[model samples]
Target chain A: MRRVLVIEDDPKDMAITRNAVLRAGLFPDCVATGEEALSYLLRNDCAYILVEPCVKGLNLPLILSLANKRDRKAAIVVITKDSSLTSERKLREMGILYYMVKPADDMELSMVLQNGKAD
Target chain B: MEKPISILLVDDEADFRAIISDHLEEKGYQVFSVGSGQEAISAAQEQDFDVALLDVKMPGMDGVNLLQMLKEIDPSVEVIMLTGHATIETAVQSIKLGALDYLSKPVRLSELEVTIARALEVRHLRRQAFQLRERLRQKEAFPEIIGKSRKILAIQQQIEQVAQTDATVLIEGESGSGKELVAKAIHRRSKRGDGPFIVLNCGALQESLLENELFGHEKGAFTGASTEKRGLVEVADGGTLFVDEVAEMSLACQTRFLRILEAGDYRRLGSTKDLKVDLRIIAATNKKLAERAKQGQFREDLFYRLNVFRIVVPPLRERKEDIPILIGHFLANSEVGPKPPPPVSPEALESLMDYSWPGNVREVANVVERTLIVSQGLPIRPQHLNLTSREVPLVTCGEKDLLPLEQVERDHIQKVLAAVSGNKRRAARILGISLRNLYRKLEHYGLANSEPLKTAL
Candidate 1:
């Protein structure tokens, strides 16, 4: 199975994301902070990186740059509770393939991850 | 037609239900008022409701229980709880139980309208999301089949079943019923999906041109043959060749094509050597090829060879349930002018639904395009359609408007000829008359100097 890295600070959201990723036929490696995510990326290569923009100790730009540099084939996905258009624009500018809001049904989230498109 | 928003109002108070129903009906919403929960469930089972207002304090099957049941029946229907007494616990519980909103009894009319509007908006967004997901899932395979009716679903299943094999497929349907789309879907799902898909319309050319196009001539084979050209059959090697209007093939071309179908090889017009090719054949016809074969018009052997598998696409009139969905799809995707086309009124939709679409799906698309131009960003009404009669009537009963039968016939002939850009063959076909007969009529009518009019029925 393909591997996906999920960075989420909240326990409830982490569990939901982990289950959704598993349901999409991918292995999920969960981390609570950007630092851990960066370390994990340095040590391993994954097909996708699903991250929450407000994760603890988050440095979105640095982490995205490093993630792209290390795993050139990995696709970045942003899942957050914030539905603000500005945040979506910034994440889009950072070049993410998927952006999903919170409370998205598991089926929809899994579909997005498998299809690699937010819509 | 834009469907009216339907609401299900369940309250024991007859006066309240009547007043609310009147208000909603005034706003052009279809309201189904029920005095008890059982009636509401029965109503829900009968037809789809966009929103439901349930009274929390009902005699039996209270609001919360009814909410769960309704959600079970159709999860997409938005529900709101209405109670005389409001409590924090009940409100939170109602929200948790999937009620979109909770309203206290004797609610202000303005507030109720606002809440109902919000619920409708949410329902719309949810529906859009569901449709998007469905399209995305099938985007790689056959996204062209847009209808969800039973007939369309059956056709989709047939496409999936036939696409797994390399057997020859014969698709039969009315004109403009999307036979080519089904053929392409089969090719896309086949093992040779990476290979090219070539299409040739047999009715669009003469016998000689069709044969030459299918099987090219060698260099110096003919007076105008300057270079050796590869035929469509050769180009479609390792792929699929879709032959549209195959019933129109002449006897000579049919004989040559039968040779290829039987032997898997064919010789060019001027070449003695037989060229072998590995290609799947998919043929489509709007006419009954079997009847043609029985009448000695179409080759029987070729018909049987191409009929290894058959998919019959029903006409638009047979599946009227899909009309609304097709209209939505066309309106959303058409690039005639601005970002969005004007909304279609209910009366116009009813008119469209009642009319018999003689030209099938293509006619629907043509009507939509024409209305987009005519409406000019305003709400589309029945007058904007201008359907059935594409031109002014030439034989009205009024004395000044009435014309002689010969005059009317002559004018109509000229109009049809102009519509088809003076293509006499097509004009004859559209006029349902023979080419020779049409020529004699044109000569007798003296229609040599008539100007072309860009209109067609």
Candidate 2:
């Protein structure tokens, strides 16, 4: 599998997501800010792009839009601290595969990665 | 890079207009305030505005009447109706008249801003969608293949043989040799020519994202999915999906792609429902697939499935005979309006022909465009040519290599296109080329501005 790209500003959240990927037997390349994520995506392919809702010096919407633009096929899973209806709707329109609230368990994350679709 | 969005405010109430205009201008909008519907109509006729705020009950002309006139002038300008009386009938009527949103009077500034923002967004999307549809419609006419060399003739013959069949074809070519153009030609000549011809760059996105694009997700399918979205497979139901750079797909994505090819059955990212599609897939790659398959870099089964029918797009170096003809085609096909391209000196032509086109026809196109820009309206001189430093032109020293026959009839059409910002109809009229011909060249050179990257997917 192509490695996942984790875009989380919060070190704790980034650690949790990175650990979850490792436990699932997948390697991931983590970026701390949206700028790093954008540069990374331009040159590297991401199996799944896990993005944070907000990051320092980076507009969340523009990042997601650029991500969506650069890679239309990648499943974009948003890791958001605030999943208000408005933000959810906005990010959804940005064409993300899903948005999970912060502090999600490793098991749930792994399950979503594998066999989340009932069909 | 983004120009400020301009707004036209029309309200009969002077005090209301003054207060709202002041606040909006403070927010950094280029606000143009007028007191009545008549003034709004005249102002709209005078200048292009992004959005128009019209009061429902205006003195001289009602908002509804003015709305029709404004739309007649420019249907793209977004209009928001403001009313003091809360009548459901008027609201419905305003909407029917193509009002973006209806706002009650005594409108809070914050709410007004939100409405205005939404209106602007709608305008932007509508413009994007319109441009997309126009390009697709224009893309229907395929360009004349500009090569008469044996390799190109063979490829053209192969295209003729396979165009009518609904088969999976893998086009192999070097980058920039017009692999995508060949795909479009195949689609144009196919039975599905009338249907949507969608394209995806397989190498551009990762495996997981590619899956979402091919198979859509449902509402609440993931955290951010608020509504059910359709995928490219569904969109390409009756047409063709041209997946470019198929060799760039990861092994996992290749497996998924093969499954789709095998069964035409797939599920969206999160949905439980299985979607079956009926369409032909045309995939292209510059890589030698068989070699890659042997090296275990590509799956043998997927390669076999994709290689059922193959078209090798010969590189430009193999067809040096076509260079002059190709130059003529490019010169005639310049995006420059009515003005014909300046004549090319024989020496300049020799330099262009001698330079190895590492970037293939795409590079040739760029050189032609850049040379045209540098040459201005003068005959193309040897110095006007911009080639890589490595390819020293075989220039005849000391002689001003001039063409005995000055084919300077070309008026250098760039100015008309610049005047119109590449609007094809006006360009066609000035250049005397058919609208379809202009579109074909523009599409070939990738000059059309608002190409629908997400749409027709």
DockQ of each: 0.02, 0.08
**True C-alpha contacts between chains kept, each model in order:** 0.00, 0.00
Off by over 4 Å in 2: A1-119, B1-144, B392-457
DockQ of predicted candidate 2: 0.08
- Compared with the true structure, what per-residue lDDT tens digits does model 1 show for residues B1-457? 9999999999989999999999989988999999988998999998999999999888988888889889888899999899998988888988998999999988888899999999999999999999998888766455777788999999999999989899999999999888988988899889977876777677755566667667866766666454554566876778888898899889999999988788788878789989998999999999999999999999999999999999999998899888888887788878674576778999888878877777778778778878888888888889988788443324446688778899889878878888888999999999999999988887787765656566755
Query: Could you tell me how far off, in angstroms, the CA of residue B368 lies in candidate 1 after the best superposition?
Result: 0.8
**Residue lDDT tens for model 1, A1-119:** 77899999999989988999999999999999888988998788887888898887888887776666542457777888886655754575455655566654465457656755221
How far off is residue B405 in model 2, in Å?
Answer: 40
Candidate number with greatest TM-score:
2
DockQ category of candidate 2: incorrect
User: How would you encode candidate 2's per-residue C-alpha lDDT over B375-457 as one tens digit per residue?
Assistant: 88799878988687548656675546554332222223344566566566997898788999877756654555542222121
